[model samples]
Target: MAAPKEIPLDEIQWHDPFEIQRIGGLHSNTVLFYFASSPFFDGTSNNAIVYNQAVHNENMNHLIHTREAFEGRLREMTGLEFMVAQEPAESGPGMGTGVWVIHKQTRRKREPKDEIIVHAAYYLVGDHIYMAPSFSDIVNHTMITITEKLSKCFAIADKARTWSPSTGHGYNTASATTSAKAHALESKGTTPMPNTQESSTSEAKKPTRSAVDSRLAEHSFMIHMQYGGEYMDENPITGKPGEFHLSSTGRKDKMPTLALPSLNTTMVSSSLTQPDKKDAKAGEKTPKTPTGMSKIKRKKSKAGATPTSA
Candidate 1:
């Protein structure tokens, strides 16, 4: 067999992973391709394309929606059968992930089987969406290694990413994004980065209250009167009966107690013990009809007539 001709090192072309490209039609607005890293370091005859997009679009705003559109596009463009390698999983709160794999066989039957696999993933960070796509020969280490790295990189980058609702394109330079976030927290009166020293000093300076002070704190009461509005202090007595208190705002005055006439115990006792004069006058009409009664009456008449007859 003839020795294969060696290609010069200078002729070798390197793929640029940090290329930025703008794509349209998946969403109403354009999707920004922020960064793409390829895993094809060896010079091979496999035609593979790997890229990443930090995207913002109302239609493709979430991880689920983005995955659908992305996978649909890949199938339509590549005309290959693709399977869901990994379903959308939450890497963190308000974060999701998805991965899809594709296999393509060589066109000719006599030629050795050349399998190509395409891997893609997406992330929903804040209101922004990020997607990663990799294309490589379905060799064990090439496609698998790249896909794992891609997911890890996306998860790590989630913390630094932010989205703005007002602007369709929420992405900004690193320095600008940080400054804008800091300004926003300040305006909203939120402590994005709390000061431990100030918090400790304030806590230390607070004096410990006594038990008596704590007990008396809830002693205050509001006094309400029938005729007037309520007041915080106790009600005071006014001079005259049925009169409002001088200090009282508008409350009704207290009613006065009634005094009874004094009673004479001696006069009450004589009146109860004395006999009526009407009964004594009726005694003269009987005239001592019975014997015993007549004797007694005669003796009384004689004594009254004169002492000489005795």
Candidate 2:
């Protein structure tokens, strides 16, 4: 196929690729999470990232340094940096701490919690990325459903998800994990209601076997970050963009969303139980889904789409 007219490189960055994403009705600062699958960007040799507001300090620091070095190491490797525009690194009004400028540029989905909710994951296999039913979204910082179309541009694969017991964290943690309250209970010895029920459930779910077989144990693949996944693929007409395609198309022409699925719950022992909780208050009213969320967004090809300012 013939390439598009060669526009001057300088003319391009000013507004070159000629593509943009549109997100309406969102709060000015909403994260554009799990949302990339670009044609012009993917064809190049650079490997890039998918991002969310939850970026961690370590990953951010690593990216800045890596990008600086990528300039000099192009002969050996290619890398890129990404960040969701809304969550650009800014000084605080957060968890009692502010991020230094150096930590804001790397586009990694930083998780604030130490709670490693789900361990059973599909990491890279010999050279393939695992395919799954659905994955977590960095946009809303939540999980979304998956489709067959997007699976193509990726080397689909999976792995066994595993986790440490009584992780002492969120809903995914088993009752066997921690105290009912954020802190230890008083000497009263008598625990509260929800915690009491959770303790009982945990006691019954503990597994007797030392190991359990899971899909995450069987496959693996290299990582690529784009929120769109294979459904947004352009190279493969159908699915599964094999290694040959990956070598041919660098990060720009070939990347999927940076997202994964997490198990909602884990079993625990009565002695190790804790409560399952969320940020929202109990029995409180919930907000209605806005019009924008009525349908899942699908990606369009470069030949037909126009870029939106937002």
Candidate 3:
């Protein structure tokens, strides 16, 4: 389509004269109007469009003022020419009925073709005018919504996590207590309480086999240290009994004793008969046998000599 002429804002004149031709008791307003499927169409059978003339006039004045203000803003900034064009209805429902405010800048080109750039858009659905969302606005809104949902999911997962080292995971004391109580009530025979049973079992298992063996070894060592020398007298190599008795007998047999010499009866009688030796001279003495001689010499003398005359 050919682009609209770019007119300077100062050269344009403002007018408010509105005229409409009535046909068959029906009239249509064309100031700031666009062609679209609306309930307020000119030749429609629905006559509620002009039910209140005062309200219709007020809506037209408001649209006129809004367009004037928007154009004044563009003129103040870059003095560029702008126009509001009707947007075509899309294929889907509720996709049409909006106006686009397009900015027109003359581009120097070899051919006479102008490009129209849309600065902003407004939707006049009923009486309300809504500004269409920009691309950045839509992206920011979607990101914020997703972040909120993700945060809620993380919070739920954190609450569900209950694993720990000491108590393990999902340990419930109340459930255990309830089961114990139920078991106690259901039994017909005499049985111990849960606490008593636990205590008895723990006490019964206090001394393990290894601990008992260690204690027994310590007691035997103490007894050996106290009475080992007196009672433990068995020979280690021969396994004989009487080690202490044989040791005592050997000690007694190895003891030393004093000895005396033996004398015959004849000698004793001679000595008794010659008792008055005071008159005998010291040198004139009979030959006497040495009494210090060993028993072997005395025995030989006895055997060699014949019986002496009495």
**Sort order, TM-score high to low:** 3, 1, 2
Most accurate candidate by lDDT: 3
By TM-score, is 1 or 3 better? 3
Misplaced by over 4 Å in model 2 are 1-4, 13-22, 25-79, 84-310
Tens-digit lDDT track for model 1 on 179-241? 988986564447365686998799788754432344343333112235346445566656787
Each model's C-alpha lDDT?
0.41, 0.32, 0.46
Q: Where is model 1 poorest over a 10-residue stretch in terms of lDDT? A: 27-36
Q: Clashes in each model (backbone N, CA, C under 3 Å)? A: 0, 49, 0
Tell how far residue 196 is off in model 2, in angstroms: 99
Estimate candidate 3's RMSD in Å.
26.3
Best by TM-score: 3
lDDT of 3 at 206: 94
Q: What is the C-alpha local distance difference test score of candidate 1?
A: 0.41
Cα deviation in Å at residue 49, candidate 1? 8.8
- TM-score of predicted model 3? 0.27
